[model samples]
Target: MKRSSRKQLQNRRAIWMSIIVLTGMVWSLYKLSASLTLASASLPLTELAVSPGKNHAAPQNGTSRYKILIDPGHGGKDPGAAGASGKQEKAYTLALSKKVFDQLRQDPVFEVVMTRTDDTFVELEGRAQIANELDADAFISIHGNTYKDPDVSGTETFYYADDSFVLAQKVHEQLVKSTGFKDRGVKKEGWKVLRDSKHPAVFLEVGYLTNRNNETDMLSEAHQIRTAQAIANGIKNYFARF
Candidate 1:
């Protein structure tokens, strides 16, 4: 080969190598930015608004038809599930439950009461006792699930004993419809809060945190609000029949 041609070939090889390095660097940076975005995006935007001084009397919208208690699972030291994007299941559950409360409050008939409005933790038994004290028509515990196999994703509802099956059915069906997640069906479990409650009660496992798809969806405010609205609507429908 000619000396000039050899020099030209070397120069071209160097240029191609530099292009490859630059492309790799850009790709790495893109991935890093995406990860950071996900991490920050998972943070909860809503904290408890109602304080001890706030009146517990259900907000008056119109007619007084029913009284319900909503229990947001885990809080304070109890981070229900460690999500892939560093989201805490406890925070998500609380946010969703609050949305449900707001939806129910819109209907003057529903006198909704939450077990805890803040980040404080309430014992499982204490949660049920509060509902009993209020003589709630029904009790609903809001929670998220987790699994070793990150692929497991779905909504499951559990009844304390048996009489609460109807409530579970109503809530679970609405959750599946709104979230578009697999319907794990109503189950029977002796969850502490459900077992000791005087009124009929059910516990909801919204979705598996270990699953990336579920984690992403649960982190979204829109999804949480929709889920809450669906549960509220289902409760209304269930009571309308009575």
Candidate 2:
């Protein structure tokens, strides 16, 4: 072969080799990027599974600082309020109550007990009796409020007689602070559960079940969880002062 022709062929071969090498590098880069993206996608889920509270601090006195008696108001024969979409207030209240119970159970400071865990009727007096018998540190009655006027919306907290005012104020304030809901102010009311219970007790009317918008908000699991956490935080903050 002529030297020039041989040289040209060699140059062509080198060009092809360079093209192959460049293509492989591009493919490797793509694979590495994809792996990195997959790893990032899995990080949040892995972190959540490893230690849920690593992202956010756990409650200060979880399940140990005091005994909290949780009462889910209205079940069985009483179907509380019927929402526009046929959602029952009784069921919603129980669901929220259970969420609150679960959140409180995480803390070491609380020895938590619920008056009823299922869709069964627990009488008003029966609830207070359980708290009294247990000699609980605090009693919280979970409930949803109803109003004929759908416009009447917001959260209201009530204390029996006078002894529970501080707890009522703390919980109500924390709820509003956490949720940005309308503050309906803490007030005094005669409730069988609060009145008969020896422990400091408060009845929480979380929101208006009769209002369609409010009911929708209350029905969300996220909202329920936040409300529960807010109440738990309020309890923690209250005791922190001690």
Candidate 3:
């Protein structure tokens, strides 16, 4: 009821009001900062700021290019078919596949990958899985053929999927022309590699090891080189359409 007492009470009230306002503003600022942090963490990796000196440009059309997977059939424990002279199918396939790999690597447009670079045995399904995992544009499986009759001698290519027919045709054409072998032509077959492959795939029975002539030519270094070139050219021709 005293005037001095009323003034002192009003001053205390003013100080408490000021404190309450300041506390609310601090809490509001803290919530805003926490929300901003959460938003930043939720952003996708591609949307994040890249480190300095690093290039993280937006993906350009057609810049990713094509990836090709070359698989040499059989290896290590699996000798595959054997010629009369004891030359194994695994050896020939590896030799030829390496040459093909080298040829494709020389071209900038193609990115080449191999299933097995050495004498290692890769499971049948695993070979196809590799191509699928890498998202290969094409899968070319190199192999040699065998038959009960030695007279069965020729070059043949097989495809399981409709999308692979064109690829098989292109490669088979070059194979027959380059190797000077009888054109067995391209045929459809549900080979594991061809069947399991997500992309276009071809299984090449290059020649019959049972045939004396076919085996001899396949064993030659010169023949292998030319055949590799033919295979690489065939792949290039197939990709040129797209």
Candidate 4:
């Protein structure tokens, strides 16, 4: 073969070899990039993401669980109203509030907290403060009513905020039905707890302790459980709006 032809042939071989080397490097880089991308996608998002803080976990549907604050009215030194049978309002409120809390706690949709679990004095303003600090979705205060006329017997609910009126109505409706008492209906009042709470708040005067019939029913365990169930149902119904 001619020397020039031989050199040209060698040049062609070198060019092809260089192209193959470049192609191989390009393919290897692409494979590395693709592997990195797949590994990144496989990593759990929660592991990479920062937490939003100490709030309740959301449901599978991406909705947050409702945070409910239950306040039992008039505790410790504050005995509230007196029953005909001498039952203190504190005792009645605590009992009923606990029942409500228990029912609510059973539902995974709700995260329930109580201002006072025992007969401890929690100031009216303090109760609201707790709810506000916790960023509770709702606040429910349980109480027994009293009047100059012992015959004034019924279930009444109070709310201070305009937004809370619906909550009051929902709870009061169930309360009246459960207690089988005359429905005094929902009323607006600037009670300390209702007024101070940042969230929707409802104050339940479950029954007039001054009335013999109301007192008897309010003090009964079965009646208390029924009332608690009603209150829990009302709260669940209200949360459904969200």
lDDT tens per residue, model 3, 135-227:
788899999999899989999999998888888999998999998888898999987888999888999999988899999999999999999
Model 4 scores worst on lDDT over the 10 consecutive residues at 52-61
Candidate 2 lowest-lDDT run of ten: 52-61
lDDT of 1 by residue, 95-175 (tens): 999999999999877788998888988877788899888778888899889988988999999997666777788778888
| Candidate 1 residue pairs in clash (backbone atoms < 3 Å) | none
Taking every candidate in turn, the Cα RMSD to the unseen true structure, in Å, is: 21.5, 13.1, 15.9, 11.2
What is residue 45's positional error in candidate 4, in angstroms?
29
- Candidate 1 vs candidate 3: the TM-score winner is 3
Clash pairs of candidate 4?
Answer: none
TM-score of 4: 0.74
Ten-residue region with minimum lDDT total, candidate 1: 46-55
Candidate 3 lowest-lDDT run of ten: 51-60
State the lDDT of candidate 2 residue by residue for 87-150, as single tens digits.
8878987898898888988877777899889899988889999988877777898888887788
Give stretches of model 2 more than 4 Å off.
1-65
